[model samples]
Structure formats: structure tokens, C-alpha cells
Target: MKHLSDNEKDTSRIAAALAEDLQPGNVLLLHGTLGMGKTVFARALIRALTGRPDIDVPSPTFTLVQTYDGLICPIYHYDLYRIEHPEEIFELGWDDALADGITIVEWPDRLGSYKPRLSLDITLSNADNDPNKREILIETNA
Candidate 1:
């Protein structure tokens, strides 16, 4: 699906809509440049899934992975930008997370040949007409 967001609120609403269909064992691959609101959309989706608006959803840039426990099932958010090799994901327990929870990954191209089998891919891009506007595309290969 293609979604256009005029601002953060619109992005969140789209995220919420997507979140409604998410399930454990699902993988979400989010692609976007820095400051393109990838993490913003993630935060909204996480909150919608967990129904806990107070939960803090920080980008897992340096940490590689962050696990959230309050949701229906664990939510594993991973950022592979800093990973130099795809094998690093194995060291970080990628398989374990996939076996147990919903895994959302940023910079997933870093995974190389280790891509997950079933996943929702979301790509975000800036809109030329409005600085705050963004174009998001969501697709699934399941």
C-alpha cells in the first residue's frame, strides 16, 4: 500500500493502521535515509501494538537491538546500519528473535543473504512539495 503523510500525526495514523495487521513472527523491514521519520513510524506502530503510549521507543542504532516486553509478544527492534558483516546479526541472536517475536529491522539490506522469509517492507521518502510530508510504501513478501 502507498501512504502519504503530511506530518508526524499522519505518519502515526498510518503506522497504527499497519500495526492492526501485525502478528508475532512477522518481520518488518524499514528503509529510509536518516531523519526521514523511520523511527517515528516505528514508535507509533509499537505503541499501537502494545497499547502503551508511555513506552519509550528509541532507535536501536548503536545498540543494534532493543526488546520490548509489554506488547502481546516481544517486539525486537534492530538497526543493522553499524554492522559491518551480515554474520553479526547471528551473533546478536537474530534467529532467536525471529523464532520468538515480531522483528522490525532498519537498514535490513545489511543482512545480505540472511534475509527473513516473511516480512513487511516499508520504504520512506521525503516529499518535494512539503518539508514535513513523506511518502511511505508498504509491501509484504509472505
Candidate 2:
């Protein structure tokens, strides 16, 4: 699916829609450069899944990963930006999340050859002429 987000509200709306269909083993690979709406979309999806519109969804930048329970399924949000090696994920107990929760990864290129069996790849890019506007694309690979 391709979505045009004129503003953050539209992006969040799209995230909420996508969040509705997530399953336990779902892995979402989020790709975007700095200042893109990657974290914004992830936060919206996490909030939707938690059924808490007011929930505090912090970016997993420094912490590397964060988990939320009590949702339809657990969500493991990962920010791989600081990871210098894919093996670093193992140190973070990544297998635990991969086995039992839906995982959303940012800067997934850091994963190198360690790709998931199936995943939804979402990419965000600035729309022409508007820095705040973005073009988002979501695709699944089997």
C-alpha cells in the first residue's frame, strides 16, 4: 500500500489502520532517513494496539528496544540505529521478542544477512516540495 501523509495526523491515521491487522509473528521493517515519519508511524501503531490513545510511546533510540504488553499481542519496538553488529540484537534478548511478539524494527539495514522469513517493509520519504509532507509505502515479502 502507498499512502500520502499531508501531515502527522494523516500518518497516524494510516498507522492505526495498519495496526488493526497485525499478528503475533508480524515483523515490520521501517526504513527512512533522519527526520522522516518512521517513529511517528510506529508510535501511532503501538498506541492503537495498546488501545490507549493517550499512552506514552517513547522512541527506542537510546534504549534500543521497548516492549508493551496487554495489547492484542505484545509489541517489541526496536531501534537498531546504535547497533554496530547484527549480533548485538542477540545481546538484547531479541530471540525472546521474535518468538513471542510482533517486532517493529527501525534502521533494519543494520540486520545485514539476518532477515526475517516474512515481514512488512515500510519506507518513508519526503514528498516533493514539502518537507513536512511524506510518501509512505508498505509492502510484504514472502
Q: Pick by TM-score: which candidate is best? A: 2
Candidate 1: segments with Cα more than 4 A from true spot = none
Q: What tens-digit string does per-residue lDDT give for candidate 2 at 47-97? A: 998899998988999999989983767889999999998999988767887
lDDT of each: 0.88, 0.89
- The top-ranked prediction according to lDDT is 2
Poorest 10 consecutive residues of model 2 by lDDT? Answer: 66-75
Q: Give the C-alpha miss distance for residue 139 in model 1, angstroms.
A: 0.7
Q: Check candidate 2 and list the clashing pairs.
A: none
TM-score of each: 0.94, 0.96
